[model samples]
Target: MDKIIKTSKTIRAILKVLFWVVAVVSVVILAAILVALFMKGGTALDGGFSITLGNYSLLLNQEYSSQQLTSLHFMTFANVALFGTLSCYIIRVLLNVFEPMSQGKPFSTTISVALKKLAYAILIMGIINLVLQIATNLIFYNVFDIPSLFNADRVESCSISIVSDGSFIIWFFILRLVGHIFKYGETLQQLSDETL
Candidate 1:
């Protein structure tokens, strides 16, 4: 019993460290991405990479007027049902495995600690996507409402060009998909339990 407790304690400690590390890294990376985006989008972002800080207003520029940004955003949202289904459908289902981890003795000792790690990740991504959605919408509705916000002076979510990059699109899809997969796992576990 003592050994099991110690092992669980160690795993919990490791998980705590890993969780904070992931959270910190996520924040830092997000900040850097915002900074980079600002630099690339506006006058405030014009310095060297190390000192680079550009205009936040440029986000309103529809940066890909010449590219496919508009279509990409449309595709992402238009297929949100598909995206949601494909991305988060079963990710949460597997969470039941850990549900017992909280109470000590679980239905399946076979559940790997890795599942905990993965569930942690999916939760984060789901939250981040929700936050990003809200933030972008606020920027569109409020931030861009200011007359001087943009160089060319535009106000629309479609006017924003963050979606212009294909790589960014791919990255988002990957994150969303992983989150969904994890959610599906959690959900399936729940549904099975309900039937049983």
Candidate 2:
């Protein structure tokens, strides 16, 4: 129990730092996009810019119109920003669950509630991501005339894919089950406390 509490505290501290880092990085990306938009004539982003951030590297050597480049940047930025925001929220939910565990209350109602919140957040984000992916794919294929990466040969007739990979749905069910298990643990903990 002492070890668990210590680990929980450590994880909570790390999550706090991660939340702030994600928030700051997202804000910086957004600010950069806005600045580029305002300084379109003077910015290299409109012409050829090598974007090497983290694992993503895009070298825009081909000539593209300013509007096309800006649109691409905005879409890319929106995707990154959305992912960062969701990651921060998930971290926050994890922190909430860990707080009680850090205080030696592993089976507290707070943990159950936090688990449920996390489950719901996962479900909501999954649906939103699915929608965005479909929309983005359609736009890239139809508007930009880009070949579909997923359906390489079927680019001539882009069809809407409703088939889910089932990863998110599986996660939602698993988290909900875990939340229920925690709720049962909380009940047992309450009963034990009363008996004592």
Using TM-score as the measure, the top candidate is 2
Give lDDT tens digits, candidate 1, residues 1-196: 4555555556655655655555565456545544444343334322231211254323333223212223333333333433343233233333333344544543343354434444445554555455556555544444324444435545443232233223434554565565556566666777888999
Q: The CA-based lDDT of model 1 is what?
A: 0.44
- Model 2: which ten-residue window has the lowest total lDDT? 141-150
User: What are the candidates' C-alpha RMSDs?
Assistant: 13.6, 5.3
6-101 in candidate 2: lDDT tens per residue?
999999999999999999998898888776655544334343645443597656454445455565566666777788889889999999999999
**Alpha-carbon error at 192 in model 1, in Å?**
22
lDDT of each: 0.44, 0.77
Error of 2 at 89 (Å): 1.1
**TM-score (C-alpha) between model 1 and the true structure:** 0.29
